[model samples]
Target: MRIFDVAEITRNIKEMCIEANYSLTEDMVSVIREAAKNEESPLGRRILNQLDENMKIAGEDQVPICQDTGMAVIFMDIGQEVHWEGGFLEDAIQEGVRQGYQEGFLRKSVVGDPFGRVNTGDNTPAVIHYQIVPGDSVRITVAPKGFGSENMSRIFMLKPADGVEGVKNAVISAVKDAGPNACPPVVVGVGIGGTFEKCALLAKRALTRPVDQRSGIASIRELEQELLEKINRTGIGPGGLGGTTTALAVNIETYPTHIAGLPVAVNMCCHVNRHAVRVL
Candidate 1:
């Protein structure tokens, strides 16, 4: 078994927090560019261009792309053969977020409590998810999800007979309801099947995927394409100013579910789509 240092993990998470906030991923950038190219609305094309410029400026200036730095959400794929040393893994991750947000001068958006509503101060206690996989290496992805789009996300438990059409309608309805509130040119992550919580997680995970990549499953891939087309037809456009580029991409992730229940969750992400990764 390979032993890994917790300090190393913390250091990487710190960098990821800063970098993800300051830069937009290439995949997201490419999607925005293409969206701009195909956008029929003059205002939509302009908004997309401005968005690209904002990202470029953020990277060049080493500043956040948006004012809302967002809550730190991390996903870890830990190899069963790997052992962590130096300290508690969760603590290390939280420490990293605290340092990154503090040092980078990022906005501290996380609250200490759900109802009491007090600031976490340093965005500590990051939301982290782990999956055990086969190798000795560990892969961590830090995705800073903003609330504007996240709040617009929806989930539905449909009857098995509701089927594909139900999912399609739900997605369209969610996007339509979201409208300008989600900031438009959003990324839609649909999680089908699984339990309620699992489906929600799958949706969040889906947003971390590369915008241009499709599922390996042919049926799922086709559905993603179909959803993207239909979502764009909503004419939410960039900044919800009205255009054909309502969504930059539609990603779907599915899992086995109970025979009687069809659970679906949608996670919305704004144009920024900030995430970073490290592997060791």
Candidate 2:
């Protein structure tokens, strides 16, 4: 078994936090460029251009692309054969977030209480999800979700009879209701066929997929394509200025669910779609 230092994990997470906020991934940049080409509205194309510019500036300056640097969401896949040689894994991850935000000058967005809404100055204590697999390496994905889009997320419990059409309609409605608020030219992640909470988790999981990657399931992929086309047709455009580029992509992740119930969740993300992954 290979033993990995916790300090290394901490440092990597810190770097990921900064890099993800500052740099727009290549796949995402390509999606924005392609969206600009296909955009029918002049304003939409302009918005896409501005987004591209924003990304370039952020990279060149080594700063966050958006003011709302977002809550630190970390996903970890730890190899069972690998042993952590340092302190608590979760604590190390949180420390990474704290140091990264401080060192990178990224905004601190996390709060201490839901109702009280006390600010956590350092953005410590990230929302961490962990899984164990068979290898000797650990893979971590950091996704910083801006509040604008995240606030508009939704979930619904559909009867099994609602079927595929129901799921599609729910997603469309969520996007429509979100309107310009969730930030147009967005990526829509749909989680289906799981328990209520699991559906939400899966929806967030869908957001981690590379922008150009297609779902493995043919039916789900077709659904994703259909949703993408329909959302863009809404003319929400970039920054909600009314154009043909309302959404850049739609991704769906699914799992088996109860026979009597069908749960669906939609997680919305802005064009920034900031995420980074590292393996050690």
Clashes of each: 0, 1
Clashing pairs in 1: none
**Candidate 2 lDDT tens digits, 1-280:** 9998899989999999999999988899999998888888888788889888999999788768998989999999999999887798888899999999999999998889989988889997788889999999899999988989998899999999999989989998999888889888889989998798999999999999997999999988898999988887877788888988888889999999998999999999998898999888
Model 2 CA lDDT for position 152: 88
lDDT to native, each model:
0.92, 0.90
Best by TM-score: 1
lDDT (Cα, tens digit) per residue for candidate 1, span 76-102: 999999998999999999999999999
| TM-score of each prediction | 0.98, 0.98
- Over 4 Å off in model 2, which ranges? none
Candidate 2 achieves a global lDDT of 0.90
